[model samples]
Target: MKKANTHLVLNCIIAEESITIEDVVKKTKLSRPTVVNIIKELTEKNIVFKSGFAEYTGGRLPTLLSLNANSYFAIGIDFEYPPIRMAISNLKGEVVLSQGITVDRSFSRNRIIEEMFEALERMIGESGIPMEQFIGIGIGLLGYLKANQGISLEILRIPEWKDVDFKKLVKERFGLPVYMQNDIHMMALAEKRLFLTDRADDFAYVGIRPGIRAGIGLAMHINGSFYGGVHGNAHLLGHMTIDINGEPCPCGSKGCLELMAGEPHVVARYKALLGDDPDAESIRGIRDIHARSLGGEAAASRILDEVGSYLGIGIANVVKLFGLTTVVIGGPDGELYYGLLRDHLKKNIFKNMSGELDIIVGRLEEEMYPLGSCFLVIDQYFKEPTLDL
Candidate 1:
C-alpha cells in the first residue's frame, strides 16, 4: 500500500509539473505527513526533485516538485511484417530517439532477433543512457497475443511468429523486463493517454492497414480501461460479416467487412472499375487512389464511395453493439480516406437511431503504433489500485 501510494504521488507530480505538497495532498487525498514522507523517499531516489517555489498567498510557500524525466527511460518496439520500428522514450512519454529497419525475407527468426537486439544496443549506446536506467522494453505486434503469458498465439502474414514465446525471448536476450500486447490494443492505450484523455471513456478505435493480409483491427476503451476479452481477442471488428453470402474469408466467414473495405480491396475495386487501362495498371496502393481522387478521377471517386459505404456499415454495427458515442478511424489508409468516408459513416450510423455520435479521424497516424508501444512501458507508474485515502 505504501509503495502504491508513493507511485500515485509520483504520477501526480509527473502529470502536473512543478506541483506543491498541498497539490499532491489534494490530488492524492493523502495526509500531510504521508505525502511529505513519500515525497522525501522519491527525492532520495532521484525520481523527483524540487523545482522551485509557488507564490506565497498563504503561510509558507511550498516547494514545487517535478519528476526527473532523465531519471529513467523505456524502449518501445513495433514489430510488424516488413519494417520494425523502435523508439526510446523518457519518463515524460517523449520519444528521445527512434529508428527503423526492414526485415529481409532471407533472414531466419534468430537472425531477426539478433538484428533487433543489435539495433537496440546501438540505440542505447548512441543515446548514452545506462542499461539500468531503462525500466523495460514494450513490444507491440499484430496478432492474437496471450499478453500475460507473453506468447504469440497467432500472427497474420508472419508464419514464423505463430506460437512463439515472444516475451520470454526478448526478456532473455535483452535481460530486461518485457511487456507485449496486440498492436491495436497498444495503439488504443496510447491514443487514450496521449489524445483522448478528455474524451469519452467508452469508445472504439478502428485501424485500417495497407493490405488484406492483416485486414483491419479494432480496440475498445470501456469504463476507463482498455478491454481485451477472454483469450485477449475481443475486438476483431474486421471479421464482422457485412454481407451474409458475399465473398469468403480465410477466417471461414462470408462477406467480412475487411474484404470489402480494406486498402487492398479498395485498390482492387479501383483497378476493376478502370478495366485494362494502362493508367489503372500503374496504380499501386491507397496513396495512388487518393491522388486519383484528388485529381477528380470518376473511377477513383466511385470506388472510394463504395468502400466508404461498406466501412459505414461496419462502423454502424460497432456503434450499435457497443453503444459508443465516439469512434476513431485510424491507420494510414484510414487517414487517407477519412474525408470520403465521413459522410457515409454518419449516414449509416444514424440510420439505427438518433443520437450524438462523433466519428473522428485519428490524428496520430503511423506514430501511434510505436508511441503506443512506448506507452505500455510508461504506463507502469500509473497502474491500477487508485490512491484514494
Candidate 2:
C-alpha cells in the first residue's frame, strides 16, 4: 500500500505540474517522513526526478519533483464503434502516438480483435520502447456493463454481438489488466476535466450516434453528496418521450428522445431530403454532410439546427429533473452539434425553468471513447486494491 501510494503521488505530480514533498504530504496526508521515504524510493527508481528547488519564500527552499513524462505511458482506447482508435498518451495526457483502422463490422469477433491487437503490437513495437514502460491498457466502450462479470452488454443494431465478455477476453488475450466503462461516461469525465471546473462534480452527458445514451448526474456540493439515483438510469434520454405516436424504441419505450434526435433519425431525415440514390451514394452523402459540417457549410448548419433542437429537448428534460448546471453532448455528430447545442437548449429549457443551466460541447470526441477505455485500465491498475505498485 505504501508503494502504491508512492506511485499514486508520482502520478498525481505528473498529471499536475511539479510538486514538493510538502505538497505530497498535504495532498496524500502522509507524514513528512513517510512522504520523504517514498519520494526517495521513486527517485531511486528514476520514475520521479528532481527538477529544481521551490522559489525561496522565508525559510529554506524545498526541492520540487515530477514524474518523467516518458517514464510511463498510458494507452487509451475506445472500442465502441468502427475506426478503432488507440492513443499512447503520456502521464500528463499528451498523446505521443495514435493509430486507427476502419473496422469491417461484419468481420468475425476474434478476427477483429486479432487485427486490433496486431495493430497495437505494431505501434508499440514501432515506438521502440519496452513494454515495461507501458501502464497497461484503458478502454471505453458503449455498452451495458455488468461490472461483476466484466461483460459488456452492447446492442448497436449490429448482429453477432450477443453475450460477449469483452473485458475478460481482452485481458486473457493481451495479458494486461483491463478496465472498461460506458463510453459516454468516460467522455463526460474528460469533458469535466477539460472545459468545466474540476470542483464541479456532477453533470449529465448525452450521446447521440450509433446509439443513444445518457449519463445524468447531480454532483453538487450543496446537495450534500453526488447523486446518481438508485438505478443509474435517471437520464434515460433514449427512453424519454418526444413524440407520443412517432416511433417505437427497443427499450419498450415509444417515441423516445433518442429515436427522434439520434443518428437514425438524422439519417432518415437526410435520406428523405436526398430522394432516391445508389447505396454507395447514400453512404457518401452521410460522410459528405459530416465533412461539410466540419467545413462550415450552410446546409449542414441547418440540419444541425434541427438535430440540436431534439438534443436540447432531451437535455432540457434532464435539467428539469436533476437541476444540475451543465449538460454535455457528444457522439459521432459532436463536431456538428457543439457549435449551437447549448444556445438551443437554453432557449427552450429556460422558457419554463427558474434556475440557470449550462450546456457545453464535449471536449472528448468519438476518438476519446476508446481513449477513455484505455484510461479506465490505467486508472484501475493504479488504484487496484491488491496491487502494491
Candidate 3:
C-alpha cells in the first residue's frame, strides 16, 4: 500500500527534480523518522534509490534518494496519421523502441488493433525489457474522448469507434493499465518538458492538425504542480471564434480556429489557389511540401504565410489575455506556422499589450503527438522534463 509520506516524498522528487533525504525532510516538513521510513520503503520497492551523495555541508555527506530512471518504463502510443505510431520510454523519458502502423480510410480498425498489439509485442520482445517494468500504456487519440470513460468522439473518424471503451478494452485485453487522453493535450506534455520551467510556466501550446486543439498548461510554482485544464480541453483556441462568421465547423461553430489554422484547411485553402501540384490530405505531407517550397515557390510560401497570419491573430489574443510570455506552435508545418504567426503576433502584442513574446517550436516536432502521450505518463511520474526551445 502507498503511504501518504511516500507520496509526499515522491511529490518532492517530482518537484525538485532531485534532492537528498535531508532536503526532502526540509522541503516536506516531515519528521526525520517518517522520511526515513518512506525512503526505505521506496528503495525496497525499487521505486527510489541512492543515485549519489549530496554536497559537502562540512559534515557527514547525505545520501540522495533520486528516482530510479530504470525503475520502470512507459509506453506512449500516438497516431502519426498516415502511420499510427507507438514508442517505449523509460522513467528518464528515453525512447527505447518505436514502431508505426498505417491505417488508411479503407483499413478496418479491428484488424488495425490486432496489428498494433502484434507490433507492440514484437517491439517488446526485441527490446528485451521485462513486462513488469512497464508502468502502463498511454494512448493519444487524435480526437475528443471522455478518456476516463474510454469513449472517443471523432476527428480521427474511427469506424465503430463509438462502441469502443478504449482504455477499459485495451487494459482488459492486454492485462496492463492503459491511460488515454486527447492528442493536443498530450503534445502539450511534450512541449512542457522540452522547455525549462523558467520559460514554460503558465504557457499554452496550440497545434493545427486535421483538427484544432490546444492544451493550456499552468506551471504552478506555488505548489509545484500544473493543471492541464478541465478535462484537458482548456486551450480550445480554434473554437474561440476569431471571426464570428466564416466557416462552419463540426463542433457547431462558425469560423473556428481549426478552419483557419488546421492542416486540412490550410492546404485546401492554398490548394484552391494552386490547383494542380499535390493532394495534401495529411499535415505531414503538407509540411513536407511547405518546407521544400518555403525557399522558392511564391504560392506555397504565401499559404504558409497566411496560415501564420491567422495563427498570429489567434495567438496574439492568447498572449494579451493570458499574459503568456511564450506560446508554442507544434504542427507538421513550421514553414507556415511560427514564422508568419510570430511576425504578426509581435506586432499585435506590442501594439495592444505589454509583455515579451517568445514563440518557438519545441523539440518533438516530428513525433510531437506520440511523445505527448508518453509525456502524459512520464510527467505524472517524473517532473516532465523539457528542452530549451
**Which candidate tops lDDT?**
1
Q: Of models 2 and 3, which has the larger lDDT?
A: 3
Model 1 bad stretches (over 4 Å): 58-60, 211-214, 294-296, 351-355, 385-389
- Global CA lDDT computed for model 3: 0.67
What TM-score would you give candidate 3 relative to the actual structure? 0.81
Q: Which stretches of candidate 2 lie over 4 Å from their true place?
A: 1-16, 26-29, 56-61, 197-199, 210-236, 273-306, 338-344, 347-355, 365-369, 384-389
Looking at model 1, report the run of 10 residues with the lowest lDDT sum. Answer: 346-355
User: Using lDDT as the measure, what is the rank order of every candidate, best first?
Assistant: 1, 3, 2
Q: Per-candidate TM vs. native?
A: 0.91, 0.78, 0.81
RMSD, every candidate, angstroms: 2.6, 5.1, 5.7
- Candidate 3 lDDT at 143 equals 57
Indicate whether candidate 1 or candidate 3 has the larger lDDT. Answer: 1
How far does residue 49 in candidate 3 sit from its true spot (Å)? Answer: 2.5
222-291 in candidate 1: lDDT tens per residue? 8888888865678888888989989898678999888888777777877888887888777877788879
